[model samples]
Target: MALDSLVSNFFWSNSDGSGKIHWAAWKNYRNLKTREVGTGHYIDVFKDPWVPAAKQFRIPVNNDISVNQDMVVADLVQERSWNLQPINRKIDKLYLDLISKIPLTSSPRADKLMWAPARDGTYSVKAGYRAKTSAIEGRTGVTRASPSKKVDTRIWRRCASNPVCPVCGDETESLEHLFLLCNWVKVAWFGYSMGIYISPRNIKNLGFWLEEFQLLNDSDFDYSKAYVASMLWAIWKLRCRMTFEQVEPSPSEAMEMTNRAMKEYWEVNSLFPKAPTFAEPEASYKWRKLQSHTLKLNCDDAFCKKNGKGGIGIVCRDSEGLFIKGWAEQVSAYSAFHTEMLAICKAVQLVEEWGMQSVIIEMDCQDLYKAVTQCSFRHCPWSLHGLLIEITDPVQNRSLVSFSLIPREGNSTADRLAALA
Candidate 1:
């Protein structure tokens, strides 16, 4: 009744009758509270009512104004319950976006979120290694095991304290440092940032580059983000190469790796049901055989498996297998195959620069070849055809241009050279 000074141990105090309510009153209380109470005993709060005179809160018989059991304090408390609706509202939308991006809904997207220990009192990291000897393939998604623990390390640097770049140790080892700041990485980043196919010569600070990254527009953001992610992934991969795999990728090799990664992610994600492939269905083109003195420059471009770095390889071989000349040029660009076709047009400029005459130019890229060979056509990136024609117009009469597909294997040498580019 006295709310402020209500004894918490009143039930225990009433055990020997030193409290406000008694044991005999409990039965009456229980009977009164019984209908409203859903389950469980409610009279455990009180014990005995026979104690010394110093402890009596009330006399039992005469003052019975009968307390209402319905108003019992504990009975007034509601059951604690959980509703998943609000949680679902927040998570369901996020999950839908996630599933839309990553269709395989079951895979764990976050490393820290899904990690669990094994039954053997050890982490699954060890269990995954042991699974290699079991009747199961260890690395696939079916194995229910992750890649080796070393692969999941957060900090990749050897010098963690006051750390500097591994490539050029002049700057601190951080994301911006390793990516946009370090001399070695900055050059490659700049090569991607600038329109140069070649990496930059020097990188002094990351702050300077961060400014550039912040200033990039939406299109530039996509390009720069892909470039940065690819380059970072490549750097991590190259570190794995040297540390775990005992193989190291050269700067150029690493740059190419970055290109391939970005390209692959784009192409693979583009193929999704929701995200339709942006590439046009390539049209076919007819080729006209040209004279030997008039070199047919068959230029093919390939983006690597990761980044979209442009590699253009040109084969100037005659009708015979005897090699005339080949040129492989690596361009730092995030554009897709159509841009590769544009690079071929750029290669025509290179050919003209070499002072070659009566050229029969060919490409494995059908859409680009068709667009270049024809005067009128409609295609996505339709404006490019005009640029293609304009680039080739000078040599159209003096030289002929054609497009055809050689087997991918036959094109290997050129492909390899292009990949190197």
Candidate 2:
């Protein structure tokens, strides 16, 4: 009821009746999706915010118009496929391509409104409040607004305090001074890259500096921002330590801490799983060639916790080590071992379907290899015992099919395919 009232009030207050609300309040909430598109029934083709590619369906020319305000997206569809002729004439080629890609169900249902802020299309008051507060902090360029408000050094000093920065002890304490101008911060940021320099004269504000940094290093923007944010956090920690604990903080130590923190943050929040950390392969490690008229299958799996999904990659090579064919598929799996087992099972299925003779299946997973070879699941968990049994069936039926364990280095092609999937 409260949510409905809040939404009603917002729509009523807006003069244009457009559902566009200022998102500055939720800009700091990194997880917010912000953009939404629903099935096109009531949405105005030219005026409404249903077209994600262009953000809105606006005609480029001032004196000319393409689509009518009353026209909805459903009007552009005839049967299941898009009526491209009218749509192409109305919108630009880029937007037309994007629209064509939008999947439509065979049995179309009523247009449903969706919340863009959350993955499940549901909003929470707690998330909304946190996003709003985070936005405030970002605008003010402060770590914590409450602490800054409560601890007014001027009030305690009984006079106008100079507010010298704890790090450099030379400049006034401000967002710029604390994050950018401080000697310690400069050392921490510029120490690794002497080529990159932050000039105070060019930087109008901390936000502007961060934006410019992102533009300059577009490819590595995420990692660069993460590193910079970690550095700022470390600098703030150092400042707090100096003021409260009367401890002198080393710039090197702070940089080291920032590196560790960034690593942990990447591990936890990254969209893709980190590559397995393995030691250097032995000098003898290499892809072994198969016997005459024999085919070799190299299989690998990649699991990403962010999406709770996994990918299976299998490559077939002849006795001469020549590439034959490869297959990659995205699958749902709980664990890496499970994904590996699935990949092995998929390989067996492919071999059976292809009617291949004298095939050798190679994989890097040691546990899966042992399970397949031993064919004993007395000690294996109930969950994996069935999978193990299924994997061993092909070997038992087809005497020509064999399983082998290989080092990850020898399975580079499959590994690459899995990661790409």
Assess candidate 1 and give its TM-score to the true structure. Answer: 0.29
Clashes of each: 12, 0
User: How well does model 2 score by local distance difference test?
Assistant: 0.69
lDDT by residue for model 2 (144-259), tens:
53454335533533432457765567877766766677776777777754235667788556666777888988888777878777888897798778777989877787788888
What does candidate 1's lDDT look like per residue over 3-106, in tens digits?
A: 64466455345454243333332232221111111111232112222111112211122223433333221332234111223223323343322212111111
Every model's TM-score: 0.29, 0.37
- Candidate 2 lDDT score at position 269: 78
User: Candidate 2 vs. truth: CA RMSD?
Assistant: 15.5
Per-residue lDDT for 15 in model 2? Answer: 44
How close is each model in CA RMSD to the real structure?
Answer: 32.1, 15.5
List candidate 2 stretches off by more than 4 Å: 1-43, 56-63, 106-109, 130-161, 165-171, 174-196, 200-421
